[model samples]
Target: MSHFIHQHRFPVLLFAIVVVVLAMTYIQPSGKAEAFHTKDELDYFALRSNMDLPIGGNGLFKASGECAGCHGFDEIGFASVDANGNDVNVVDDWRATMMANSARDPFWRAKVSHEIMVNPMHKAAIEDKCTSCHAPQGHYASKFMGESHYSISDMLLDPVAMDGVGCAACHQQSQDSIGLLFSGKLKYTTDVLYGPYDAPPPIFGSPMMAWVGFDAQYGPHVETGDFCAGCHTLVTETIDLNGVLTGNHFVEQATYHEWVNSIYVDDQSCQSCHLPRIEDDVVLSTGYSFLEGRSPYGLHYMVGGNTFILKLLKDNISELMLTANETHFDTVIARTRDLLQNHTLDMELTAEGIEADTARYRVRLFNKAGHKFPSGYPARLAFIEFVVTDAVGDTLFASGLLDEDYNIIDRDEDYEPHYDVINHPSKVQIYEMVMGDVNGDPTTVLLRAAFPIKDNRLTPVGFSTSHFAYDTTLIAGLALTDENFNHIDGVEGSGTDDVHYHIPLNGYDGPLNVSAKVYYQAVPRKWLDEMFDFESDEIDLFRDMFEGADHTPELINEASIVDFVTSVRQPRPTERLKAFPSPTSDGFITIEVPESDRMQVTMFDVSGRMLFNESMIVNRRFPFVVPDKAGVYLIRIESQRAVYTTRVVRQ
Candidate 1:
């Protein structure tokens, strides 16, 4: 990469030589000390400074116990940065997580804490849209306090900023203040601070290159897609029509500018294929606590289609699901069924794209994705299905549905070829989907979550649809059928695995009798938890909807295709070691190795194993303490092949 950008151009021009080399070593003290430039300083000589502004996550979301001194509070999870022997915490993938209950998202902090008590001027614009992206590294203006809830370190009360986005709120960025994202435009590293160990920083950190949070990553409108468009590009103002503020508008919640006008933005960029670079692990993966000191690695708990938060962080629901008499395992995957298998429903009773005096007839279902066809996270849900037959194939017609605002809508509901988070979101959800009138009873109100939530737009597998209608006799025989399809989990597609029985060739042409196959499923998180009333039985919303009931409705109710490190997998990487430092820093990471080589040290997240160790080896560079409550981890130091990867920065 241009000799790694010309060996980081003179170590980032030495922060313009930190004002003449820290004022010629700032008043004498050369016992070999360096680094510390401003944006606010602190370094009792140099115990690793790292102070490139953001003012200590707004005082650790205004409660400063200094983020568990290394985030290990009440022992939550994810801190396996630098370890000697045993210390792992992704607290079983963040115990009961939604980023550890993003501080209880009851309709998004109870409608912005009730609009910060009847709107205190939109309470810092709803606490800056709920801390940029759930405390995008905490300090959300001292966790907002307007409602009063304390318990900092990963949020307990109104640390509105301490919700999910943690870790010194994004490796604490640099490069002249990462362009001050959000209200600004966007930027991840304008001056470059990427991670994975080039070491030294925190002795008043950043000399243009500050990310020791473990490298591999940015900048230039941050590689366009506007660095994920400052929280997927959105803006919302209130008190419109003469009320003054004039509804500031701006819209986008994740079309990411329709993938920046896509053709995959000419050649992809949102970190090319979603932060991919980990030189082949079937589909990118790495260790040493996420991209640490770089080696073509980047991924770590960054999966897509949200899998309903990876099914509450890995309850797996028995490897997503299966049945049809357990079809003798080997690997088939297709649980709860949503999208993948070619999407189906081609049609031809007359209208192909519909709209000319249609008695309900339209078809063109297609959805493709090497990744991001509603891939993961942003509330996934795919669509399309029109089965209207007549001559003996049975079934007259049918419309899709899953509603309660899960909206599948039917007419075979081809909700724009699928790929979502929002296209309607109950007419734009800012938070209020309770509508219904003709005496259906939802009282009133058309929409509100705050308005503008769903709009995923579609067209990934070539999404492009318009001109609709399918009154198809209201649902002919109703039975595309599915009890528990089969299996094929990892996901990729060509479409068509069974489920194709429509005889409506209303325009057939011989040999084109068309026969196809491709059906698979496993979905049984308790039969989709009966079918959702939702209240969390410790979150098994039928195992978080088979991580989106894959097989496709955009892999409905999704979660966990595993791999938050192999879906809670652990044990592998221990050079018979140890360390010890835990006034219980959350899960307490400190073990020491050298008691007779037979080592093992482990910690896993995304739901599975909690801690592990095979012991013996009392000393080799100890200082382990990471119970959890931060993020990004995976530390394996096996003695077998002599593994020794390192990357730690817990503060």
Candidate 2:
């Protein structure tokens, strides 16, 4: 009998394996059983398929598709419609946004691969933290099932993970310590779906629970900026090149903190702008005839500054395995472009009058957003494109010109410094943040970033350096010293920048036409140079897509003046005072005056500190010596007629 049992043991083991496989395959939800023949087969299918599977986890969260049946587009009841009777279903609008496709974003995939490639030792930590925000459903659900790490490979195989930032990722978030949880640390409830509205009647709520296995409850925290801060306020731990932790944390992104320091903190929230509210009454879900229309419906557009990625997704819908069609992407793209061009900023270009054969214009940019203009990712940037042309469209002076590849021409090798006055076309006024490594060298790698080498991005209105949150959103580089940057009369929180342009006429004093435009780039070429240098499958895929797409920067705002004549012959009182030997080596400068009345002369350092002030009587030449320091100094000459400010370089 013992010999017979041993001989049949192999057959019994094979039978047990078959039984386990059949149970795993057949024990899925009612509708998903037909999707796979075996557990191994399903994994193989998901690995190759570009489309996201309609599979929810056995843990806390469900895939976004589970909520689509009730909240998606409805032909009969016309649920989730706007004031114009147009369908504004939550699922449809969100399906095409960066938020919905966060996990599927090629750039993000490539960047994750790049980071892991740079620091191979910390691959587990990198993927765990990155997917916590980008692929929250998969990451957290794995954690719920006692898994320590959810890798990029695991995300690719799991349909729930590929759902990116699905409905459950936000709706299932717990109100406990939401805003206080920085980085990807988010707490989710076990079986609850939270919305802005109160608990629904059992008639609708019972069906929702049956369909998605979650009860509908009201969560006021969903509409708060602090709630969004869980992921938006990212603080990453610094790591050395060899993947060792440096014991220092870097504020990779502080968008929420930037908003807290602004005036909009009192009145506006993240949902107010991204998920715009509509006053029209509309039904929240379909298949329920007794459902009453709700007021102040929030559309889930989730619009942001990433039009470049949106276009890439639209162009390669089939390749990316995206659910949204071209038409859906077009709608989101149109709304995003509208938000960027019409609502992001306000620009005014005024001719301050030409002085001494040079055209003087002031370009003032007012940040209209709740946070910084180009907030969030460090790679995003905005720049001024100032052009002075003659009547025949002959370009006289042009700054911030882009080459064929959409790179700003003549940009500094490392990074451009913040400029109060741009006298040369090579000096472009770019509002961007540059990251520095442990050695104070410029770097694109986020893990190696020690601090912000330069962060001159435009601040929002009411931004103050003394605000509690300002340390995380502090302004860096020369912009800190720029008097006209976010300051008025030496007071902070103006939230505007005044860039003065002094273009040389070069003896051609014809009527000049000045055109100034603010251009924005989500992914500038300079930011990609380092990433493209490293070779990987994800990086190569994105490189092909990015290289094939149009690289033109979006025009945020523009202002133009036509047929402007300069009064060079009849110089103003302030224009008459000219300083000879501008770059004075000996610190002694002679100010040639027009023999005017007694004037008030003042000297100020770049930081707006008054260095010297005197009431002097100028006969013809008034000589004065600047400080011994070799730096740029502002000279202000005020007569009874007018006030003039000029910059002098002391060597």
Report backbone clashes per prediction.
121, 0
lDDT of 1: 0.31
lDDT measured at residue 421 in model 1 versus the true structure, 0 to 100: 20
Candidate 1 deviant stretches above 4 angstroms: 1-57, 61-133, 136-167, 170-296, 299-379, 385-481, 484-498, 506-509, 513-651
Q: Write the per-residue lDDT of candidate 2 for residues 1-651, one digit (tens) a residue.
A: 000001224435965996788678766666465634567757643433345335445466777767776787775646888767888899878888998889999999999999999999899999999999999988887888778988988788777778888889999999997788889999999888888876444325787787667888888899898889888999999997667899999998999999999998888998888999988988888877778888789989899988899999999998888877777788899999999998899876656666678888888888999999899989999999999999688999999999988999999999999999999999999999999998899999999998999999999999998988988997999999999899877778978999999989888756677889999999997899999999999999999999888777889998776423433335545564478688999899887766566555778789655566555665567787888999999987655455656788998
lDDT of each: 0.31, 0.83
Angstrom error of the Cα, residue 206, model 2: value is: 1.0
lDDT of 1 by residue, 1-651 (tens): 000111224334755785586567745475554544553334322322222111122322311122223322121123332223122222212222334334343324433454344445545555655555654534233333232322223333333243354433343344443323543232333222333333232222221124222233332343333444455534344443223454334221334543543345566656554344444211111111342222343432222333332332233324322111121111112211222433312211111111121122212222333322432222233343333433344433333334443434431211132221221222110111111222332211111222322232223422222202111001011111211111113222222111222223333212111111111112212223222333443233433343443322232221101011111122334343333332344545655443335433444333322333233342465555554555534455434334343333233
Over all chains combined, what TM-score does candidate 2 have?
Answer: 0.80
Per-candidate RMSD vs. true structure? 26.1, 15.5
Instruction: Point to the candidate with the largest TM-score.
Output: 2
Relative to the true structure, candidate 1 has a C-alpha RMSD (angstroms) of 26.1
